[model samples]
Target chain A: MNAADLPSSCDLVVIGGGPAGLAAAALAARAGVQTVLFDENAGVGGQIYRGITATPVEDRAILGADYWAGVGLVDEARASGAVIVNGAIVWSLDPARRVGVSIAGKARLIQARQVIVATGSLERPLPIPGWTLPGVMTAGAAQTALKAQGLVPDGRTVMAGAGPLLWLLAAQLLRAGAKIEAILDTAPRMNWLRAAWHLPDFALSPYWSKGLALLREVKAKVPVIRVDRVEAHGRDRFAEVAFGSASGERRMKADLLLLHHGVVPNVNLALAAGVAHRWNGRQLCFEPVVDQDFGTSIPGIAVAGDGAGIAGGTAAAERGRIAAIAAVAALKPDAILPQVQAIRQRLAREEMGRAFLDVLYQPAPGHRRPVGDTIVCRCEEVTARQVRDAADLGCEGPNQMKAFLRCGMGPCQGRLCGLTVTELIAEQRRSNPAEVGYYRLRPPVKPISLAELASLPISDAERKAVER
Target chain B: MFKRLGSTGTEVMLKVDGKPVRARSGDTVAAALLAAGIDHCRTTPVTGAPRAPYCLMGVCFDCLVTIDGVGSRQGCLVPVREGMAVETQLGRREAGR
Candidate 1:
């Protein structure tokens, strides 16, 4: 995308090109409303459907049905006549529906009548000891590489932590012909008892059959260890992973250590835009407060997809359609959206058994709140001890801790460390995560060069306000 | 530690630490680096410890590398271009390049 190709203003601007944004943009455009979608990646598919248009992998069967389902989304979004822009880094979105975006290092501000943020989710950070080593990466990273580049880990690989996605990735990697050494399951066995209450709904849901098949597929090939404690051991790059189970302590030589503990709503952009958010104890992260229509506290802005909450990709698309229908109705008050009810029905079905998955996958307290010498903030290299010590000194919340220890002030802007720091503080204070609160995020949400800001066209009124 | 499962038809060349590395057309700088066996992209600014791309989705800054003439570019976000120059960042950005 070039700077000149950008619009000065638009009817509806959708940020993120995931399942939610794609569905929303396609619906809005098909409804005769002018819509523009911006995605940071070179391709339109968000992480779940990454490389839908440009994947290098020739054998489509290896990626499975769920991964290829994104093709319809990309096709519909492209055919709907929405102005879709790729390689667009949206840095700022204000309460007034003004968006600051950069393309190819050129910046522009566009005023939007209605905005839909469908930024989706990022993998929860697993901050075990030596996790910052070179060979250690999030499980999502491996999936992205495989989906986009047809690359696989050639060396001995050991995946730690537990979630539905972890098993899915293991299955995908094995199908891709990648070698795996072991899978260290960090999910507490007792969670099964707590999650049993929701078993009826889960058994009826679509995930039951697919999850069973996936687990069976991976379990046949890989050594699955139910470990209570796990850590990476390496000097410069990852060389091995160690885990302690009911039997005893054991170690495995590994060239790659993929870590996962489920995903959380990526709330930085929505939070920085002044949307109301609360800590979701069940999901163990902060999520934007949204109503049935997916509308945010800001009148014209809406949040959909995993960014609103951690529903899967299919549910996210339905949420996006609902939000888009609401947007069309708001922009043109007389517009009739007969499909709204149908979309909601689909969403309810898609969201079936989500509670069971959430309860089953909720990370243990120890994993979320690591202690001792384990590094909490990867950017600042601040250890868990330092954060605990700061909390003991009466550091109120993430903001005060940032001022005191510079934990969330790094280049990543608290994306990697905010949840860990909040949990650590909450544990130390014997308070809940909600009371501890999250970092007060500000914009330029994604980093932008100073030169990009300097090149923006300025007006006399703006200049006078600053000059005085 | 990573290998390409197949080719994407066209291949491009990039310089990682002043050495030419062959990369597929659609691969990001980070993916190309990983395939070329360059694990760590940069050392952290605070302690100068080696760090690699943790989250390839642009959330983690561990993939920061010097691209072209600019410093601290997200290698995972930037697609590998033909004859692009990528340097491993040792520490914090040097003053004025």
Candidate 2:
């Protein structure tokens, strides 16, 4: 099929189907723009809102189902005459707002007056010795497995890491009949108390009460420990986890370990399109540098969601709506900016709340650095010692480590090892992890084969756009 | 949300590792497995830590076990089938191994 064979043009093209993308598409279509939303997942909610489809209505109340519930957004967008495209993975974005997408094993190019990139974030993996053990997983991944797939890790489980997500996941596991061996949270004590100040704002809603109730039920049934770090051990698989607690270092034998630190933005498409970006010290990731309009260096192209920065679901959705409005305003300058300004103010408030929550739930500094012998990159089986050795050899950056040891050049595109590598280098350089900067996300983020690119439907216009 | 199966007062029987475990049909596999008191699943390759369903969704791979000899299957996601054979997978095992 040729590019012309597809829809010649649309008013807007939203490149992700998560809360942000869905919100953007819905708002754009509501404004009478011909909009299409595409996503790689079979469903629309993205990772943060994983179980929207499977969770029953009664359970939805406790799960914050309405918060995600992107299906409703999709239906509303479709009602407004927007095109919904599932399982569509966008490969590249040209300078002219032309998007190359892969669907049904075929690639095609779509041209739009404006494009919104709401690609969500990926979990930041903390590499420790034996992290590659079969039983280990990210907290977000665990949520998806249980809520979507109805799968369990084991009968006995240990939930470890920082953030409110740890407590949330632990509660879910308890409901699922898994014996919670321990809830090992690495959040510093001071941070937790400071984070508690925001509790009043959160507690205004009954929803917070229900969440706390569920957590209380779980805590009553299991031991919840605040630890500095976890040292997982097993020859071929994980059998024991050793951690230093207030009492002392304790080792617990368990069948599974769920580890989560936080998330970083997915910036592959933005970087590939040569969009300007800067490092966000707070989230420890590189976010696309955008103006108050959410407009990137590339004209008519906007970004939101975890792709812009790790602001969680509600913030991502708000940012997405803002980006969509800005994109429309770019074409229709006569459009009202009052609504946009209001939404931007709301986003700022949400972002402030998120920042407060993040500081309170941030991982303890000790968790950032594993013992020198621990492996940092599971894909290459690269050890902390190896990375430190490279840093000692004056390997100044993660790029040099990539060149010397191929640490961040794995299948995961460094989502798992990037932050850890940066921290390792910082430790060697006697500097802060923020000063070291995050890894650069290269193009073809999800890894498209050469044949896939060759198969893309191209037109004279799209071909010209690509050439430029 | 409500169903009646056999003499167990409408309880549904799901084959976990080829053994009949009775649970409410609407209950998640993790919940049912936990209710049935079957806890030990696969062990972590590095730490040998005993793991169970941590996140009752697909985000964490901690709940992985073999259903009908298939490895890396999230136990929380795999609904209880009538006669599914679930096994604990250590890692990505080679076909011949």
Candidate 3:
């Protein structure tokens, strides 16, 4: 936990502190391995359970029971004696199991025998025009603001997007005293058609009542606006929004415009580490390929939690535990059992609820690959037309487009544009997203100061090895 | 867009561009600024247009600001301390001491 005297190596280096990372690191360390978990946040709750440790909201009702569910697991991890280093950003990972990290601006390199990446998911790229305007942000952003800092959206606030999180956020916002505007639902029609067939399955699942209740509450107070298409419009800050609803094109003025299509696995670190990933059509994002053991394509590296794929916090914790048990077995064969029966039973139950949720919350089809001057890349302000032109000019994928139009080469590092870029190229080339491929991710995954790099304490052995 | 939902935490005083701003004990620099009616956090490097804390979770770089003489720190991520000085980030970072 000492940034000044950080270990050059450890047994396991779990790269996130969300539900999965915390579970994996805690279990692995308790199973007799030197495990250290690094999270960029000051606390351990990943995005889903963000600010659980430091949530300023005294009334937990504002956050709901599902969010509070992870509290026990977080407490367990905190008590498990795993070295939890918050505010430690892992910027790079090498094949040799070396992790480059910045802990409160001090840089260090930690080598590990086994690495588990449970970095978790990010809000999907909502590339509607004027999305980059000052007041426009993701639903997750607004939720994080409320949860982490107890700040509520003032003025007229409009919530737009699909999924349970969007509704949950709306409910929480209403409780926080945010002014009413409308909830523009961009959820795909196919989900509604498919949801009924799977409704029985969802009802039987444990999360059934919770999800339904959230939906009911949001629908009760807020005026749900179903829009065929939605776009934020403003010059300095988002002043108004234009969208086509059931009636026709309409414009509404709002102060804060929060947008969320869905979430995607945060795979920048995984891709940079050369972990194999496959495009998940249902989720519409690339998830790292992991076996039942949660081991990724590379040996000594396991991926768990929503970072591997978005299964939410509960499933992520189960996946993390499964990965930890498998990791300990891999490292110290005698320590693990032939089969973790109880854990498997729990995991099975946790997984049942996920299928129906994923099906129901998938982003609307049109929203994924937007049309008509929609800005695909918010950082560089690249449009769908420009990306198609790049493809027409023989640009094969995101990398080629990067060279051709500087689409994915921005400060946000394609986080807001990677998926859209891939889809755009895929559409133009008459192929699928997997065929078009994703941007070649590199590290420092998050930015690191040049001064911090220059100040890394080179051990005597490292200096000697470098000379050779 | 900002309002404090609860008053459990103690208040702390900080400065934004030499103006004293009051914030709670656990409030982030971005939250304090937003609560104080300061909408624009920084201006874009290329277009020179204003930007704010779009993503409070440190993912979006739009909340970049100079904190305690350090440049390009995401205002949402940095917890506010008493008497801390924060300035709007301008363009690319200069190596700060």
In order of appearance, the predictions have TM-scores of 0.98, 0.78, 0.95
Question: Which sections of candidate 1 miss by over 4 Å?
Answer: A336-338, A463-468
Lowest-sum lDDT 10-residue window in model 2 chain A: A54-63
Across A254-366, the per-residue lDDT of candidate 2 in tens digits comes to 87778888777777788777788886766666788987767899988988887888877777888888898887777676654448778887777666556555667676666
Cα displacement (Å) at residue A336, model 2: 7.2
Lowest lDDT sum, 10 consecutive residues, model 3 chain A, at A335-344
Fraction of reference contacts reproduced per prediction? 0.90, 0.07, 0.70
Off by over 4 Å in 2: A1-5, A54-58, A65-71, A192-217, A334-338, A432-435, A458-468, B1-97
Residue A431's lDDT within candidate 1 is: 94
Query: Which model scores highest in TM-score?
Result: 1
For candidate 3, list the clashing residue pairs, or say none: none
B48 in model 3: Cα distance from truth in Å?
Answer: 1.7
Looking at model 2, give its docking quality level.
Answer: incorrect
Instruction: Give the per-prediction TM-score of chain B.
Output: 0.95, 0.70, 0.92
Off-target runs (Cα >4 Å) in candidate 3 are A336-339, A461-468, B95-97
lDDT of every model, 2 decimals: 0.92, 0.69, 0.84
